[model samples]
Target chain A: MNIEIKDLRFTYPTGLEALKGISLSVNAGEQVAIVGQNGAGKTTLVRHFNGLLRPSAGSVWIGDWDTSKYSVAKLASRVGYVFQNPDEQLFSRDVLTEVAFGPKNLGYEKDKVDALVKRALSLTELNDQTETNPYDLSPTWRKMVALASIIAMDTPIVIFDEPTTGQDAVNVARIANVIAELKKEGKTVITITHDIDFCAENFERVIALSKGEVLLDGPAREVLGQEEILAQTYVDPPQLTRLGKMLGLKATVINQEEFLNALK
Target chain B: MAFVNFQNVTYKYPLTKTPVLKNINLQVNEGEFIAVMGPNGAGKSTLCYALAGFVPHFFKGEISGEIEVDGKKSSESTLDEWVLNVGLAFQNPFNQISGAKYTVFEEIAFGLENIGVPRNEMKDRVDEAMALTGIRDLADRSPYSLSGGQQQRVALTSILVMRPRLLVLDEPTSQMDPIGTREVFGVVRKMAEEGMTVVMVEHKVEWIAHFADRVIALNEGQVLMEGKPNEVLTADLLPEKGFGISRYTSVARQAQQQGLWKQKQLPVTLFEAAEGFTSKGGGGSN
Candidate 1:
């Protein structure tokens, strides 16, 4: 589903203006990454999609549904948000139950829920830990459980908030593969990430928010290559991109393959 | 004998089939900044806890071996005493906050207050620590009101204010933005230079390569390898062992096969990769 925001403005109860008047649209099946420093309103902005937070002076539309009109639980079928901290969203007793909870909450048939859970388990590489308690697992594995739960939801739009944070290299690769799978399935994936390399690799479109304003929004290559502008939001281009610029390559390289291709 | 030593160290939690940390022998010198790398469940955090006196003292585990730092054995020192010399900032910064304090400044000074530091000295130290981590602007903000990156900084500042002899950080910058991360590395690197021994578990090899004096690769509760960052980070065995090699190093490895990279040693950071890729008889692209 497409996400449309018009002049989004948000203010905390504490009188902090988290997001200023900003507007953007994410098309259906578009893999977009939002990059910015802390307190730049990245999280505050995305929270509006699933109705976790309401805009003080704007509108957020999840396709045809007005976000403000829908409760967070009601929006679950449309937008699956995997919180930054698994501990915050996870409460299931076992891996199987946790992964199955989302689909069940959306009132899917038991068979469909089971199938989705199985797919999510396999995709997140948590198959063996189905019976194990998520809290008993290491933090990294717990993150996978959180991911599987959201994936099992099978929403049209999936949001990952710093999915790569605290993940090891292998886990990171697994997360990237999950994103690739989501893209292949033609699902809309929106991620808020600080790992620029991961963002550049897995996301095609990039949106940079700087203190409640849209700093840059474009293709990953174009958006990420603007070192100075990205720096304003406390982001650096992927390592390969910076290296490409430093080497005076003909074009910017955002990933390893592009770097190698540029080298040749 | 080294300043920090782990000799035949083996540890298991209260409930577990196998030991999380197998027999491990490692040593670190004074002021040395050692970066530890490994995949999930590699016992990297266990090692950090062992060094910080949490393995046996707090976690209530079965431990067989010695962890010595600054000539004081971990077994002999209580957690309270151990924390004085060793300050640890784990991956989850949320757990580090002392909810007793409201503002970031007061939260950072919580440790000092605990140890009876003079109020004036406590303020100065907290200020200095916040300045080091580039969180001075967050002084008045409620500790709970900050972002993840800001909370991580506050957690780190809390630890830094104590001025521990051995600093243990587990993915301290995991929640930080690029700028916050860079500033953290800078602060930790400077602390290491000032004779503070550091053992950090981190996945950011690029930053580790730039600042660490040594790197230790861990797997299945054992030290897989330990050497200079370039050697350990670029080792071919790292990937097979479930460790993530830097993108530059992996690209270089592939380029070497296709005759696009020329350096005999693989690059771990972008600068080295750029040099090797652009040197004479290097990449024919640029």
Candidate 2:
């Protein structure tokens, strides 16, 4: 399903304009990343897809459905949101129950729910901890549990908010694999990240937001190469990309292979 | 004796059978900046709590061996007395906020006020600390109203004002942007230069390579490797152990294997990587 936003504007109850006159679209199965400083309105903009926060002006459409007109639960079948803080979303006694909660809530048949939960648990490597209470797990493990819950829901459009925060390298690699798997299944993946390297490695499209407006949006190669513009939003290009620039490499490189190829 | 020493230290949380930190032996000289890197469940945060005197002191469990700071053993000092000279800022910035204070400035000053520092001296210290973290403009804002990055800065400022002999930070800049992260690293590096011992648990490999004096790699409740930042961060063992190393290191390693990289040592920073891949006459291509 495609996501279309037209001049979307949002204001908090406290009178802060979180997003202003933003317009963009993600075609079906496109992998996109959003990067910016803390108050750059990344979260506020993505929250529109699930109808968590309605736009103050303008419109948001997920597929043919107007997001503002659909209930969050109704939209859950299409959009799976993985929050930054796992603590905010996790409330189940055990990992199995937690992973099952999403698909079951969507009213999937028991057989399908079990299969989805099993796949999610395996992908997140939570099979061993299925009997363990989520709270009993470390913050790192809890993050995986939260991810598993959303994966079990199996939405066509998935949004990950700072998925790498507080995760170790191993868990980060695990999460990246899950994302790759999602892309293989032709799911549209949108991530808001501070880890530029992770974004560069995973997403093809990059969107930079600054002070409630889009600063730069294009292919990761072109957009991330604009170091000065990304700096305006307090972001930096991936390490390999920066190194390529410093070495006077003609091509913009975002990953190790491209960088090695450039060096050659 | 070293300023901070851990001798055969092993600890288990209450009701937990296996020890989170096991048989650790370490030493840190005064003013040294040490960065700890490890996978999850590797006991990095537990090490921070132990350094800040939280392990056996607050989170009591089966513990042995001495945790000594500044020639004083942890067993001999109360948690209150220990924290006075060994300030700590951990993973959750939200928990560090003192709810009694209405503004960021007052919240930072709350620690000094409790110790009865004169009002004038307290104000100066709070202002200076906030300036160090570049959060001086947030002085009047409520702590709860700030963004996560802002809150992290406030938390760090709150601890820096105490001017402890030993500083323990657990992923203090986890939520910060690239610029915010650089600023915080600069502040901590400055603090170390002024003769403060810092033990930080951080995952950003490039910053650790640039600023930290030493690197300690932990895995499964033990010290897997310890050395200078360049050595530890570029070591093949780090990647095998599931530790996140710099992309520069990863790239350079692959390049070296293919005989494309000429440098004997892998690069942990972008500058080093650029220099390594560049030819002798200032060009960087095959």
Candidate 3:
């Protein structure tokens, strides 16, 4: 299963162009990250994947399902989108009910919905919070509830919009692990983020958008290695990458472990 | 007098019988840049609200001890008056913006105009605020149309136009990218340099460690530690206090363990760390 986008162009109702001629594809089970600065059309491009927004020009095809013709409800079964703010998406009284909302709306039986909710809660490490109110939990735990809601839907392609925003190191590492586990389960993962270190360490391919155009798209290591290109796009390279370049190192080092080994 | 003072203060939410803040004592000198850091539920936000006179003024709470801002007791001051003297930007930008029909210029000018500043003075102050926040070109744009980062700048500019003596920002850059974060910090640094005090509750240690003059760490609704940035951000103290130490600090500590660099003080910024490593004549790929 592959996702293909060709010559995509999206204009808001106010006649502002958000995405201009975006074209790309994600092979099945590949983890890809779309990175860009603020107002760079990264969110506009991903919202089109799940039929939330229709392109004024061009088309989006998720394994032969034309996104332009599909409704959000129809496409949601194939692609799950986790929004940036979990408060906007999670509204149920408890974590369990929130996770079960999607499966129940999709017409799953009670037993199946219960099992799916359980699986999602366990996968997101929120099983203990199943009985707790989402509003009472911390921001990180609320985010996990949002992820569990999507995972219960069992969409093969999961699109996360800035999953690590405002998260501390422990939560960020947990999210990275969740993405890695999703990849291991043969699910396609697409993330739109501004955390360059998260992109460099976890994603295999990085697609950078700047001013409604694709600036760079390739292997994450190679794309992140180009400090000049990143700076031109108004994106800061990871601190490790900057230190590596300043020291005249040959390869890009993203994490402290790699940076320390490089020094040795 | 110090701009802000808290002496052995304690507070508890109405619903919870337990105090959220316990025996807190701190002072903020005028024109200083202070960063407050802690894990979730650490009473950081509670401290900001308390300073802004929101604890007993807005929320029902039990309080003890004293808090004075600019030499006035918080209990005696009204919210409106204290809000003007000490502007606060919330963690979520969407909650702070007001007047749906207002443009960026009008939003920034609203506060000054409300205070009965002269018409001509309003324009100058608004323009100065916009320029300081790097949002001068966005004056004509609608506040709702801006991105998260741009909206945050608009919020800051709106407060800046009021010329508050102290600015309290609760996680202003939490939702921004690295570039956007730098832009927000740049404005903060400029404000502090121009003799305005800034108190920010932040989680991104690495980004602010280079800029902050002081660090105040909180845990479980109490002050865990407080000192200069270098004095607080260390291996022995940060992890135990539940504060996220910068990756650079972690790496520098490991390098010390491996006998690579032997500086007594840890470098907080990328530039400083690079210079420290290079000056020692050790561990750089040629």
Candidate 4:
């Protein structure tokens, strides 16, 4: 589903104004990454997408449905939120049960739920660990279980929070592949991440936030190219981008192939 | 003599069949900054716990080895006494915050209080620590109210205020943004420069390369490799052994295969990679 966020402003109960009238839109099936330093309001902005947080001064529309009008549970049918810390959400005894929880809570038929859970488990490469306790797995694998739990919901829009935070290279590749699969299914995928390289590789569009304001927003290459502006948010451009700049290359580079091409 | 020594160290939790750390032997000189790296379950955290005197003492684990820090044997000293010489700040700063404190200032001073530092000296030490970590402004804020990155700074500052001879950090910036990461590393580097030995477990290879004097790679609780940051990080076996090498290093490795990069040594940081690629070199398309 498409997302339309207009002039959004949010303030915590302690009177911290997190979002300072930010605005953006995302088309259906578009993969978008929201990036900024810690406490840059990336989490605050995306929480509005699934009705977890309401706009104090503006509006967020997921398709035609206004976020303010729906409860988080109501929005769950359309927006699947995978929290940053898996320990915060995981409650099931085993991986299969954890993966099935979302769909089951949404009241899907048992057969459908089973299929969805199995599909998610396989996608996350957790099929062998279906009977294993999630708590017994490593934190990296727990993160995958969390992702699989949300993907089982099969929502039109999925939001992942810092998917690569503590993951290794292999796990990171798994997460990237999951996003690619979601995009193939015409699902809108939005992620809040600190891994700029991962963002540069997987996402086409990027929205950079600074103090709850939209500091920069555009295709990943264009937005990441603004190194100085990004540095203001305490973000470095993708490694290849920085490498290209440091090399004084004529073209903007965001990946290895481009860096090699620039060398030629 | 080494400032920190671990000889034939092997440890297992209460019920675990396999030791988390296996036959690990390492030595760190005084004031040397060392970074440890490994995949999940590689015993990186276990190593940190062992150094910080938490393994056999706190966890009640079966540990067999000799661990010595600053002339004091870990097996011989009490946890309280060991902590006075070696301070540890780990991942998940939220858990590190003492729940009894209201303000960040009080939270930092709590450590000194528990260790029985005089009241008058506590204030100066806390002030100096906060300044060193750049958290002076957060002194009055509630420790619980701060963000993860801010809380991490508080945790680090709390440990740093103790002025322990050796500091052990476990992914102190795992939850931090890039800026927070840099700031924390700055404090760590400064501490090492000021003659405080440090052993850190971290995944951010670039930052480790920038600050660490030595790098130790661990796999399945064994020391896989140890050397200069560039040497170990750019080692060909790192990826195969499930170590997380920097992206720049990997990219340069790929370029080498295509005859696009001429450097004999792969770059671990962006600046090094840039300099190598841009330098007037041989055996490359450029």
Best by DockQ: 1
Candidate 4 local lDDT, A1-264, one digit each (tens): 789999999998878899999888899999999999877898888889999899999899999999999989999999999988788889999998889889999999999999999889888999899999998887889999999999999999999998987777778888999999989999999999888999999999999999889999999999999999999898989998887777677777888778777776
Error of 4 at A20 (Å): 0.8
lDDT of 2 by residue, B195-253 (tens): 99999999999999999999999999999999999989999998898999899888878
- Return the DockQ of model 3: 0.61
User: What DockQ values do the models have?
Assistant: 0.82, 0.69, 0.61, 0.59
Question: Candidate 2: which stretches are off by over 4 Å?
Answer: B99-102, B281-283
What's each prediction's TM-score?
0.98, 0.96, 0.95, 0.96
Residue A236 lDDT, candidate 1, scale 0-100: 86
Model 4, docking class? medium
Candidate 4, B160-204: lDDT as tens digits: 999999999988988788888888888899889999999998999
* After superposition, candidate 4 runs with Cα above 4 Å error: B282-286
Tens digits of per-residue lDDT, candidate 2, A102-220, equal 99999999999999999999999998999999998999989999999999999999999999998898889899999999999999999999999999999999999999999999999
Worst 10 residues of 1 chain A by lDDT: A255-264
| Fnat, 2 decimals, each candidate | 0.90, 0.82, 0.52, 0.62
Model 4 TM-score relative to the real fold: 0.96
Question: Which residue window of length 10 is worst by lDDT in model 3 chain B?
Answer: B277-286
Scored by CA lDDT, what does every candidate get? 0.91, 0.91, 0.84, 0.90
Clashes of 2: 0
